[model samples]
Target: MERNPWSLGWIVLMCLFVTNRARELKVEQVGPDNEAVYNHTLATTLVEYASAVYISDMTELFSWTCSRCDGLTEGFEIIELIFDVEHCLQAYVGVATNLNAIVIAFRGTQEHSIQNWIQDLYWKQLDINYPGMPDAMVHHGFYSAYHNTTIRPCVLNGIKRAQEIYGDLNIMVTGHSMGGAMASFCGLDLTVNHEAKSVQVVTFGQPRIGNTVFASYYSQLVPNTIRVTNDHDIVPHLPPYYTLFPQKTYHHFPREVWLHNVGLGSLIYPIEKICDGSGEDPSCSRSVTGNSIADHLIYYGVKLGGETWGSCKIVMDQRLAKFGSKDLGGNFVFSKNPASLLQAGSETGSISI
Candidate 1:
C-alpha cells in the first residue's frame, strides 16, 4: 500500500503536539506584586542572629553571648538550641523580649572559611509537596535537609516551647545559605501546622527552594519573606532553573532583595534592589551569572559562616544545665572578626560550575 506524504506529516505533527503537552512546563509568571518592603536595619540585624547560630558551644548560643549577636540580641532570651548530631544541623529558638517576638535562626553549612554550598546546581530527583501545595515540587537536597532529620522535630518542639512561654507572639525566621532553604520550610510548616499568626522570614544568600508551583504557593502562604542575595552571590542562583526542564528545575519565592554596588570610579554607591514579585526577575540578581562565593559569605559586612572549624562545640556546664533558667541569667561574651564586602572587601572561592 502506498502511504500519502501528507498523511505521514500529519501523524508526525500530532506526535510532537502530544509530547509537548505531556511536558507542559508547570511554571506561571505573574506581574510583580512585591509587598514585602526591604528593611535595612532588620536585614542587617537578622544576619547577625543568623551568624551567631554558627556557634559550637550550646552555652554560648543559649546565653546570647556570641559576639556576632552582641548589641543585637541584647533583649533576646534563648529558649532552645536545636542540634541534630546525626545530620550536623543546628538552629536556635529564642524569644526577643524587647521586640515581643519569637526568633528561629538556622545554621548554614559549617566550613572554617570560604563556604561554598552552591558550586554547582545539580539534582537527580525532585519530588516533594510543601504543607499546602501538593503540585509544588521542591529541591531534593533542601527537602531532605529540612525534613529528613531530627532537625524538624527539634525545631517544632522549640517553637512550641516558645509559644507556651511567650504566647502567640510574632515569629521571625532567618538564616544564610543552606540554612535559608531550611528556614523557608520552617516558615511554611509553622503557618500550616502551628497556626502561627505572623511569620517573617529573612534569609541571606539563599538558593532557589522549589519549582514555580512551590514558589507561588510559598509566596501566597508566607507573604512576608525577604530573601537577600548579595552581588554575584552564587548560592541564590542555584539549584539552577531550566525553562525547558520545568519538572526538574528549582525556583525561588517572590520578594528577593539583592544587594550590589554601583560605581563609576573612586566613589562607589551600594544598592539594595527589591526584585519583581514574579520570583525570577531578570533585572535583579538574575541579571548576573551568579558566580561568586565571597558574596555568599557576607551580607551587610557580616561573615555568615563564622569560625566553624570548631563549630557547635558541645560544651556543658552541668550545673548551669540543671539549674539554668532566665532566673540565673548571665552572658559570656566572645569577640568576632568579620570581613566587609563593601568598604574593605575580602574574597573567597570564586569558581562557578
Candidate 2:
C-alpha cells in the first residue's frame, strides 16, 4: 500500500485539533453552601408556572392561576407557537412576575414525533460568538428550530413587556425535559445577544446540550444555571456521553440540584451538588441508571396532594401517549453489532468514548 504524504499530514492536523480541544475540558466542583442558593419554594413555584403553560388553552392555565395563585393573573403573559414542517414542535413561552423576578419559562416536549426526538441527536457548532466568550456550539437542530419559530421574538417581546411593567427585575428562564434544554439555550441567548442581565436558568430533567466546548462556554457565560434532575430520570442521560462520533458528544451544565427519593414524601431531601461542570461527571446522572423515563416524568413529587407536587408528569402524559416506551436508549445499541461499531469507530478516526 502506498502512503500519501498529504493524507499523513491531514491525519496529523486532525489529531492535533482533537488534542487541543480535549485539553479545554475542565469541571469545577462547587461548595455545599451553593445549595443554600437554591430555594425550594421558588423552584417549585417556577416549575408550576412552567408546567401550566403546557395546557393547550391558555385560559385553562389562567383559570388554574385564579384558583391556586391568584396573584399570577395580574402580570402573566403567555405566547405559544408551532414551527417546523408538520408543526411537530409545540413550544410555549410564559412571562410572569414571581419571587420578585420576571420568569420566562419554556414548555417541554408535548407530542412524541420521531422527527422531534431525532432533533435531540443533532449536534453542531452554534457558530454564534459572544464578547469575551468562546465560540459556543449546541444541538444544531434545537437551536435552529427554536429560532425558526416565533418563540424567540415572542420571548423578546415578553421580556420587553415585563421590563415595562416590572422595571428591571431579575429574569429567570426555566422548563422541563426538552423545554429545559431550550431554556438553557434561551437563557444564554438573552444574556449574550440581547444583553439581558441577571438571567438565571433553572431547568428540570434537561438533557445534555452540547460537547465539552459548548458546556464550558455555557457554564462561564451563564454562571447562575441550576439543572434539576430526579433520582432516575432518563432524559438527563441522553445523546450519550460515550459515542463513536465526536460531534455528537453531549454534556450537561453545572450547579445541579438532584432530587433523591423524589416521591418519598417528607423523607425526600434534595441534594445540591456542584457538578464538575464537565458534562460527563461520573457523580451525576450519567453514572446512575440511564433508562428511567418514569423518573423524568415526575419532578418534586408525584401525588396530587404530595408536598412539592408539580403536574409535569400529568401534563406531559395528557399531551403524548406511550410515555415510557419512547426511549432514546436504542441510540446506544451499537454494542449489539460489533462489526458496524468497528466500522463507525474506524471512520471517525478516534473512538475514545
Whose TM-score is greatest here? 1
Write down the worst ten-residue block by lDDT for model 2: 330-339
TM-score between candidate 1 and the true structure: 0.77
Model 1, range 198-317, lDDT digits (tens) per residue?
888889988887888888888888888889999998888887878787655787888888888764334355677778888889899989988888788888898888564444334534
- Model 1 regions lying over 4 Å from their true place: 1-34, 111-116, 123-125, 246-248, 309-313, 318-353
lDDT of each: 0.71, 0.55
How many clashes (backbone atoms < 3 Å, residues ≥3 apart in a chain or on different chains) does model 1 have? Answer: 2
Error of 2 at 128 (Å): 9.8
C-alpha lDDT (0 to 100) for residue 173 of candidate 2 = 80
Question: What's the CA RMSD for each of the models?
Answer: 15.9, 20.7
Q: Give the distance in Å from residue 165's predicted Cα in candidate 1 to where it truly belongs.
A: 2.4
1-353 per-residue lDDT for model 2 (tens digits) = 99987676667656655643443211221234332145555566667655654544322342233232333334554432222223233344334543556676666665553235535554333444334545545665557545656566656765675566557877778778777877888888888888886787888888777766777778777877778787777677776665565543566668676666322223332444335555456776655786666677667662111122232222221211211122232111000111111111223221211
Deviation (Å) of 215 in candidate 1: 0.4
Pick by lDDT: which candidate is best? 1
